[model samples]
Target chain A: MRPAGFLVALLLAAFAAAPASAAFQYYVFREFGVAKEFPLEPTRREAEYRTPLLGRAVPATIFETTEDNMVYRFTVADMRAVDLVARSAGLYAECIAMAEAEGKVLARMPQRVEDGTAFRVYGQLTSVDLAEAGGRKQTNCFLNKGWLYKVESIVLPARGEPNAAAALRFSTSLRFRIDQAPDSP
Target chain B: MRRIAFTAAAVFALFAPPLAAQEHEPLEWQEYAYPELGIAKEFPASPQRQTGKYQTEVVGENAVPSVVYFVDFGDLIFQMTVVDLRAPEHVLRAANILAECIFLAESAGLPLANLPLDVKDDTQFGVHGRVVSVDLNYNLGVRQTACLHKDGRLYKMEATMVHPEEEDGEAIARFVTSQRFELRKP
Candidate 1:
């Protein structure tokens, strides 16, 4: 009986030693015609989008990740401009202001890269440390053919930076509907 | 005779002045009409009136029913809308869905704030008024309001202020509630 118990414990230890696979999931929000893949399991929530100024459809998809317990949001809007950089700069200012208002600091040395004439990408690394709770977050803003597209992910645990990696991957995978154009003002 | 004539001319120039002098005076206030709002209003006539690009239009299909009017006031842009919910169930669903979406957006660090509902009792429409929401960082403000009338039509008002001001609240509220919708085929 002692030998049998030793064998059982050995089997349990071996099973636990096996490499565990990371949970990865993907979600597609049809209203915005955008898809996102996350490193951890996320719950889906539906949202209605409305703006008083444009009165345009502002539908969104929200994903709640498990590890950092951070909510990821995707929003798309159609806007037109003669110059892409000007519009992108305007959007970046708005995003930064919004982030600051929520008590999140803008990460220094943001990554900036050019995509094409119609699109440009910029990202930041942010952290929110409170007495009770603390976490790190990353946000990416995509300017596409007069459309302002944004994706943001947050991760808890100062060391486990899942959101930063996910945000980079998501930014590289962004695509837009060709038919939608910015509404005339 | 020459001295008399020069003196007479000098007196005339000093006292009579010129016809152009009257033009420099400020213009008086004049009653004007905003045909779109269906109300006659008054404004100072000094500043020349310029035609603006802003206009009113109905947006969204039956799947998403809303009407919007855009007005350009110099540097600011004002948008007003009337959303038709059609039923009580629609209102309840919309309210919850909108609230959740806003919360999710805010959690992601978007500039959405001042979310609240407006409920009141009246005769034509049992409930009316406006609910205010804002994206301060974006300099965007939204007002969502609703009413249920005896005609069995549920109406909602959404007013967006791109360049907001203190008086915008009252202006938007008045514009939204003053709207009249047809219950049946017009």
Candidate 2:
């Protein structure tokens, strides 16, 4: 009994000393519908609002942050009255042109997910040396519901397996729904 | 036994040729030194002004010029000229020419999208949009502009892009509207 008690105490101490893990939080909103949580340190930093083209409003929320250098952004758009496909295509074209002008090479092509959402991933080479923070890579994801287009941009360090793992985890959390709903519980 | 040994030797001689001679050669080495491509000279300073909506600083100057301008809200870098065109009537025409050139470049397989061109009569400025298309379906969100002052004396053209989702279209338009140009004497 004494030996078992000692082992249990040691395990508990080890668990307590370990750093807290970060996770991407997911939310569903009635107006914009579905968005994901980013792994950012402060929960408040994850939320942002913006007005897009044609005076449409969008609100983005972050769900998770991790040491692996990954952050997630979830944006909900209200495009019920607009042509969703044309708007999304035009925006996609616009984004692609800008990236090319900046001399950023596309590491991966746009891939369609099983659930009918399309996303494009890109990697940017850093202009300055970042030996300490590792190299830098950026990934962008685009999703459209009717006239509403949601964009997610993630910046990752070139090195560090932890960052890559965190980025993959955050990307897998994307969920979309057509019904209008609020994001918070 | 001796005869058999002699026959074997002759057969071996016929089957094998003498080993080829080996040669050794020394490596030739050369040394080279490159001349420095000296630093570029700065552009002539612009005259000081008491008040203006914009200010221009010569960041780099040479055959290829670069000027940094500070507007009301943000700053931009320009690689082209910031000159004073003598005629007021030529300002809009010059802007239209630049816009057409950009459009032609895009149509010739350059990935430029969402091309927005507008001439503001009150400010005498021309706003244009440009993007560098990447692959078949990816772009960076950048906008370019050509500003002509109301008097038509100053003309400045610029290329600008927002960091992904940093600011929306309305914010960008507001920023563009507030731009002013400061021309330097040649």
Candidate 3:
């Protein structure tokens, strides 16, 4: 069989062997005293990046991977460097600017999870969206436990369809270790 | 303005926002679908559909056709209006819905107030709307309307009732939550 065909068979075999619930892996961040689950292994490098809105350098751990033509990115930012992100105009403006830097904003909605955690979903309209015919851009942010967590995923029809349900599941699985539970916000 | 919506939805309006939690008992909801608009939503009962037309611009002579699907559950009325605006120039025309809403309240000889808070109620299918509230009229109660633009079409949803209580607020949230817009392939 051709190499491409063989790879498809291998991928299928792997999917058959993996349990449905084990699609994501969980990790515990000791320094931050937070435990969370992720879809892919954490990248080996830690990087400092500038937030266009906040205008400050903050430490960020990024997990990025591509599968079936879809791009997935998950970022955890330690916001301890600056004052708390006051739910004010500045924070709102920063969020809008950050999410829409490359594409026109399609929709932006904030949700308050049942557990009292708040999150916002930012949708961007992009050219690739019209080309892919079914592509969508979503940047999701959850502000909780003194950290800002973001999950971004793009759905391209030519690739496998993106799993919004799984993305949301992974994001909601964030937990604080028992040791830090006493002071967790 | 403080962006964080408070339970101080208490201090600002004397009532909390319906977006946060469904604090009331669930009502029997029936699925409502509008194929002409390519959207479906859950409503407590069958809604009354109203069709009308208004000028896209206050001074323009062209009439923009519109439809409103609404229902009243006791003291609250939930309404959704779809305005056909496939014309490229309709972008600016869509915005006039807000002022049109204001004009409507004033024409009825009622005092209306604008709440600067922007509600973040966007569906997963990519429709976002902006919310504003008004005093409406003596008997009609308060009105909160959200306007959304997509595919050269304008969708405006409104929740209006007189003297809304906590239960009414929860019901309004339910109405907003149940809305789902269908994005069909061309």
Candidate 4:
């Protein structure tokens, strides 16, 4: 067999040998103090996040990666100095506005997770040229222990509903490390 | 008397645009696209474009390059200023550029009106932008401004009415809502 064909066969064989969930790897990031599962190691970078009510921009760390035409991103910002309750509404509004910026928001709900308050939003992003050609996005925000965390997944229209399961899995797999809880923020 | 007349003529020349702007017939709306700037919006007429400098807190002390496309209708004014914050020294501050621009506008006006509480609120302006309406101090009328930051550029849009009492509010709303930002193609 040709070298290229042999490589394909090897890849197929590896996939067949492992269970679906076995492909994902779990990692603990001491710096961000969170443990999460990702299909591959996410690229880390420093970015800025906007505060809800104060209209200020604060430093944030972002982890992002793409797999099979789907994008997964996680962001964490320390907001210890700000009042979360007073700014909770702005926080939620900003998240939803971002989703609606590209498309229409399909649904949203406030969910009480294991340790924090999470807001889940579903959006249908429409293409500017072709309205029918659009993608789906899922954004989940968490306010826990004075830290604001956001997990987002985007599946291109080409990937469609086939990658929905993986997107959902990646978005829901973010777990904060309770043991390594840092300062209040 | 001749010196006074000469000064009066100079003053009138300086203010003639606004007075002449009011004499036009009904506005003919048109859509103008600046592909290089990554923005497209509607204007009452073909707006004249000017390049200038704008100072903001994020890029303190020194002013940055800016481009403004605007149309001055005697009774109304539509202006959009695009500030390039990608300079080597100011690039890192791009994320906070919009907040600083909003702060500058807020300082010149009264308190900000209540923003939307719900994300689904339809009252929100273009694509996650912060918008506020300011009542000018000297009867310059109401100026509604929206600031959006994207791709290291700060887009500031303003629709000002010189005679708000006589002008229709729908015209301002239409111009504000007609703005659409073009995504840069990689």
Q: Native contacts recovered, in order, as a fraction for each?
A: 0.00, 0.00, 0.00, 0.03
Query: Which rank order by TM-score, best down to worst?
Result: 4, 3, 2, 1
Which residue pairs in candidate 1 have backbone atoms (N, alpha carbon, C) closer than 3 angstroms, thus clashing?
A49-A58
On a 0 to 1 DockQ scale, where is model 2?
A: 0.01
TM-score of chain B of each: 0.35, 0.30, 0.62, 0.74
Any idea what lDDT model 1 has?
0.40
Q: Evaluate residue B153 in candidate 3 and report its C-alpha lDDT on the 0 to 100 scale.
A: 62
Pairs of residues clashing in candidate 3: B141-B162
**How accurate is chain B of model 3, given as a TM-score from 0 to 1?**
0.62
Q: Which DockQ values do the candidates obtain, in the order shown? A: 0.02, 0.01, 0.01, 0.02
- Sorted by lDDT (best first), the order is 4, 3, 1, 2
- Looking at model 1, residue B115 earns an lDDT score of 25
lDDT of 2 by residue, B1-186 (tens): 999999999999998875332221221212111111111112112211122222121111212222333222122212222333223223322322222333333333324333333332222222223322211224433454433322323333333432323333333334333332222211
List ranges where model 2 is wrong by over 4 Å: A1-19, A40-70, A76-85, A96-103, A114-135, A147-163, A177-184, B1-186
Model 4 chain A scores worst on lDDT over the 10 consecutive residues at A121-130
Candidate 2 TM-score restricted to chain A: 0.48
Candidate 4, residue A171: Cα displacement in angstroms equals 30
TM-score of chain A of 4: 0.66
Q: Which stretches of candidate 4 lie over 4 Å from their true place?
A: A1-185, B1-24, B111-126, B183-186
